[model samples]
Target: MWEKGYQTPIYLFNKLIGLQAVVEVVSNHTSNALELLAKQHSQMKTFVYQNQLALDYLLSECCIEIDDYKKTIRRLAAKIKKVAHVPLSKGCR
Candidate 1:
């Protein structure tokens, strides 16, 4: 999805990844309920472990992505300011 050439593909990818992580975490927590629900509907069961390490990893990744995006915006803003301040050449009408 990132290679489609949209200017904000990174941001979109990051958001999707973050959403997936959250959904996984939530799905894991509610595994038993879901399994029971599936049983009622004659469907497959699902299981998820309640592990601190996994949650920590997801949280860290989210934090890192947020920081990276912020840094990118700051860099872009600085470059924009530089371009915006450049005076026109004498030859220009």
Candidate 2:
């Protein structure tokens, strides 16, 4: 899960760097400069949105895991409370 989750950010970083290189090369005088720029802009927008969606999905999964863990802790807390008059020790006392 960790590996998959980090893939999106890595992919986005590489794409941005690659596109920036392309933009720099095309910075010189050219008749289709505007057209090329427009295309790149659209492509960049798509890439950004796709990466965002992937990240969002990963975050949602992480949230679900967090909620699950919270529930488990709550359940354990309830069990501990039932078994003892005082709460669990704060440290290894």
Which numbered prediction scores highest in TM-score against the true structure?
2
List ranges where model 1 is wrong by over 4 Å.
Answer: 1-7, 32-93
Quantify how close model 1 is to the true structure by its C-alpha RMSD in Å. 22.3
lDDT of 1 by residue, 1-93 (tens): 445555486677767666766665554445545444545433221122224346667776322111123344444545544443434357632
Check candidate 1 and list the clashing pairs: none
Judge candidate 2 at residue 55 and give its lDDT: 82
TM-score of 1: 0.28
Candidate 2's TM-score reads 0.31
Supply candidate 1's per-residue lDDT for 64. 17
Q: Indicate the worst ten consecutive residues by lDDT in candidate 2.
A: 62-71
Q: What is the lDDT of residue 31 in candidate 2?
A: 21
For 7-74, candidate 2 gives per-residue lDDT tens digits of 68768776766675555444432324444554565667667777767887978642211112334444
lDDT of every model, 2 decimals: 0.46, 0.51
Stretches off by above 4 angstroms in model 2 are 1-31, 61-93
